[model samples]
Target: MLSVRSAAVRAQCPSCGTWSSRVQSSYRRTASDLPLSGRAASLAERVRRFHCDGAQRTRRIFAERHGEEILAPFARRTGRLEIVVHHLGLALGGGPGAGFARRLQVPVSNDTLIRVVRRRATAKAYAPPRAVGIDDFAFRRNCRYGTIVVDLENRGS
Candidate 1:
């Protein structure tokens, strides 16, 4: 089982540019991931509420970080599980992705995977391009070809 421990650390307040030690609060969250060898990987993180001594009178609760990882800010599974799900999602497609997760004893819905794929596709479609250059490529071997519009402003195709 994953357990969270409070540690002393300095954090910057988003409301004000004041740096101070974050105070621990009675808040905790645990996220589970796909099991490994009949055991599941879980993350236990502590949440803290901080008091800022800046000009603004505000208090903020910040999630503690473990090493190079940030928790609570975004929902995520374990590193290994994430890798497996990503690869399976890409290889098996969205429909089979959810099935793969079920086989692994991980709770994942098909709609979630579909939504993820759609969002990714939309993001890629509207991605910005760095350099813009026109190049001619054959659409079909020797049948059709057209000039591709390359956006040079953002380095995206």
Candidate 2:
């Protein structure tokens, strides 16, 4: 476990780009970072809530921009960790990715890895084909069937 205590006072508003020293509230959050020495490390990061004083934009309150560069929004693990996880998920499929992550001491589930890959893939812009071919495929050999839509123009996917 990685123990962290609060440091630094920040007053910058992310949305409006204004600065202030007024403190609305202070709190601490638990975060999971990258593995250290083949062991999982966690953090007790201190966070601060600030009242937005900027008049340019209209957000009443804003949280401190602490670790925003290092961590993804609402994410426990650091951005670097997530990047490593995403690469693992892409190289190895879900189950294998999870197993590999365990070997790397990340300790994440297959579902989590799958979700990570999905999120990263969805971030890119894509143009869907205008036409598609629809067919029914045997999802299970004589038990069930599912509809499959194939991109007609591309002939792939």
Candidate 3:
């Protein structure tokens, strides 16, 4: 399963728009999902490093998918790490995102999680607009209000 996914993922390199056919190595990574009760849902994936023959050198390795899911590369804790960071942002008001990193067996920083979230938000905000709408929301929880612009063109919100 891993080999197949790796092969499929390595077939295309987004950086150079070239098809990769040579695989150098393979490995396994595990990731965690949202908690079920007090436990977390985990997934293990096989990853591969590919040799890119394209110009303008870029990343040589990427993850493949088993069935419908894309697996993470390098480590098994990617999912858990993301969850921790997201939860930290919501629970501790984003300031303790870094502190949560220290709690992980593997080291991470709050700044990294903040950066990831910011990047995702920026990407979504700047995505090409198809349809636009305007709405109003509370600015201060029943005290004030403001207008919000929404893009309804995209499928995912």
Most accurate candidate by lDDT: 2
Model 2 lDDT tens row, 4-122 = 54465657888888886778987777767788888988766666788888987687678775565465457877777888888888889899999999998896899988998898778
Error of 2 at 130 (Å): 22
Better of 1 and 2 by lDDT: 2
Measured with C-alpha atoms, the lDDT of residue 3 in candidate 3 is 23
In model 3, the runs with Cα more than 4 Å from the true position are 1-25, 40-42, 48-69, 73-92, 96-109, 122-125, 128-130, 135-145
Residues 3-71, model 1: lDDT tens digits: 766666776666766876847555776766667566556767666666676776565554344542344
Q: Give the per-residue Cα lDDT of candidate 2 at 80.
A: 73
Candidate 1 structure lDDT: 0.64
In candidate 3, clashing pairs total 2
How far does residue 37 in candidate 2 sit from its true spot (Å)? Answer: 1.6
Measured against the true structure, the TM-scores of the candidates, in listed sequence, are 0.61, 0.69, 0.44
lDDT of 3 by residue, 49-112 (tens): 6677787667766433343224334434454456556566655654566665455432446666
- Candidate that would win on TM-score: 2
The whole-model C-alpha lDDT of candidate 2 against the native structure comes to 0.78
Task: Report, for every candidate in turn, its global Cα lDDT versus the true structure.
Answer: 0.64, 0.78, 0.57
